[model samples]
Target: MGPLRDFRPPRGILVASSITAAAVTYLAALGRLELLTTGNFASSQQVTAGADLQVANLRPAAEQQQQQHQQHQQQAHQQQQPSGIDTGLALSRLEFEKAGAYPQVTSQRAAAGIDDGVVAPQQQQQQQQRLVFEEKLQELASAADREDEVAHSRLLWERRWQQLWPGQAWGSEPKCQEWQASIRPRDFRSTWVEERLRGLPAQSGVEIGACQLRVSMPDNVQMRYVDKSADAEFLKSQCFAKDGAQRPDIVDDATRLALIEDESFDLLVAAHVLEHMQDVLGTLRHWLRVVKKGGLVFLALPDLCDFKYPFGDRLRLVATPAHFVEEFQDQNASRRNFEGHVLEQGVSVAGIDSLRAASGLPALNRTGNLEDLESITRNFVAMNADADRLTTKMTVPLNLAYSTMEHFGSYCEDHPHNVHFHLWTRNSMHGMLSAATELFRPLGLTFVVEELHTAGRTEYNMQELRVALRRTG
Candidate 1:
């Protein structure tokens, strides 16, 4: 049976097997064709996967670079910016930072392809408003500082005023009758003098050249007197000598004043005496030495600008011209003629040092001859004529003879007579006192002018300036 089993298959079975094999081969071939036909789709899917992986790898680096660029831009902007309070750079920075305030600036930046990186318009406006508020705050601080300085100055001025006037009002009417009772010739009473006396404290005092009157000292107040003359005959010749009386209690030699103790007197009254001294500063130093600290020194002088002589209505004449003529004329006169004023010119703040230096010049011994006298007279006549012509233009008779006689009698006299050396206005006197204090401060002398008054020339009064000074040291 095993030998007989090796026989061939049936034809139909072989045909079925062949058909199956062919179907399998055909399916394999169809699969290869499908793959060749869709080759691009497969390749694309693979490429897409690779691209996704590459993107994931580069993302962190790109984000880091962008962050670095943004940081660089922010740093550059901060470096270019200016501080709020930098005055020198504030204007330009304001224009740059608040560019939105000006429409043209925005347009210019946009045209130039430069982005300022400002925030929205609303936010920029808010930032601009904040800067303006800060500037206003700075201005207010400056104003406050100035106001404080002004307030301090005002306080200092008030304190000085209080020290000067004390209990009395600045321009108050004084008790003239009590102070002027002893002064003879009521026509010579001065309101300024009365005011000065009334302001003085009631204390021990001394008077230089007390001809007949003891000024406003109370009955209890003690006083020592000084004068240039001790002789009875000379005392009787005084203008205030009513009954040819002599003052036996007075000490002579007013220049030295050796009898008075240093810093002993509380008040020093030199009504019209200082102008006659040869060394005015030396006399003032001596007088200051005798007066105590915080004591008063009352001075009264004739106002040079207000001439009381009868000059027929020359109202159009400039005051400066007449003043210059008088000053130069006195300067040319001989020193022996003590009748001539040594300092006839008005004292001023600007001229104090020059005047003091001039006072040191050697006194000339030569007397004025006839020619000098004639020269002065002729100059005076010419000045009077010019003044008359400029002012009135009237054919009024010029009293040239009387004027020349009066001038010669006053300054060119042979004998030594009382004559005003220096003249003063209220401002000039104040300046003089201030200049003197500054000049003499090194000598431990501190003089302060407390009050100054100038009386007007009325029918009954003579123009004069009265000053009150206090010795602080």
Candidate 2:
């Protein structure tokens, strides 16, 4: 067959090819056959050269991907819970747990009460008038970025509320107000006291840095780290210590000891510092030490019992005042300049009375206890301008410097009287003064009233000063 152009395969080889085709067809018919029934070819199984082995390798990866997707979905579902709702619920529960109504109150919280509710409409109206002394306080505190002033204000307000309204109060209710006249203002026996704070002449000879502890003037403009221009007249006279040794160190609340020498200060003026102190007696003792026997300490503070900030109602609420006067020089403040004080609560008065009784001021329990404040007026507390950090950068202000006069003028008027944890009445003032005197008396300290230029909170017609006599053995 002429080497037949198309050679016919041997029957055996042909049959083998046909059988192979048939096998291929059969395998195709059973497409994607897997060794196991789990819809995946097992990757661990060894296989001859076939597509099944390739698919098996991919199956494991596919299954892993599906599992990962499911896990991701589950995790996502758990993340969508509301955290705020849970936190709010917890806070609400706590508030309710502490909620109280008409509980006996002390300090500023006493303003919220409902005992003997009968009162005159006009009187209530007068009591409702709000006085925000904190505006000025914030201005002063913000002036130097001092947060303590605001904190002190909160304390002052709380005690003030309690002192004005001595009764049961709710914890969360609005505090009610009482007429100024309702809580009769405690009058001092002007004629009974022998000592009086004498006003300083506008142009009196003054020298403050001759003593060992050099006098530090105020720094109102530079409190924020940037020095702002001040009155040229005031700035020109400033005696800048070469090392600024007289300035307060920001690191410690006290003056840097090394920087100070003997007899640096003949006068120490702090405004509204006494109110925030916990241990007034101890503080006074230390003050006596810091002062050079004859050096004077100028002070200014609020009388919550004499001002009306009916903080809240019902729940022995705390009206954290701008400050609290745990101890002070006196309770008798003039009502001419400052108004709307509410010192009705009796705790402060009692404390003051007790203190006066304990002291042998001689004038205590005298006729001066029941008269106008003109002769023997006093504010509730004193302040520390640099209380937070001891820094000479802080400064006093003109308005603050005149606090004594302004407060005295308002005090001479019909300022509302309120409550306080501790009120600084004439008796209390006498006690504090007596305590300070006792500590300083041994050092031969003399009390001489002078004019102060401090700004934080003190402003008055008179300031006290002490001069050290020649040291005795």
| Top TM-score model | 1
C-alpha local distance difference test of each model: 0.39, 0.25
TM-score of each: 0.40, 0.24
Residue 284, model 2: Cα distance from true site in angstroms: 2.3
Model 2 agreement with the true structure over 390-443: per-residue lDDT tens digits: 211111111111122222223223322111222243223543454555444565
Candidate 1: residue pairs that collide: none
- Model 1, 1-473: lDDT tens per residue? 00001010001111110112222222222122232222111122332233233323334644465345446645978766322222212222232233322211123234335544668976654554444434433442343334332222211111112111110111111212222223323233334445445545567888777665445455545777777667766664442243543253556566667777789888787765664554455567678888899887876655433322112111111122222232324553234323223112111111221212222322122234422434333433333333212221111111112222233333323322333334444554555555567656888888777877655443423444566889999
| Backbone clashes, candidate 1 | 0
Among these predictions, the greatest lDDT belongs to 1
The positional error of residue 219 in candidate 1, measured at the CA in angstroms, is 3.2
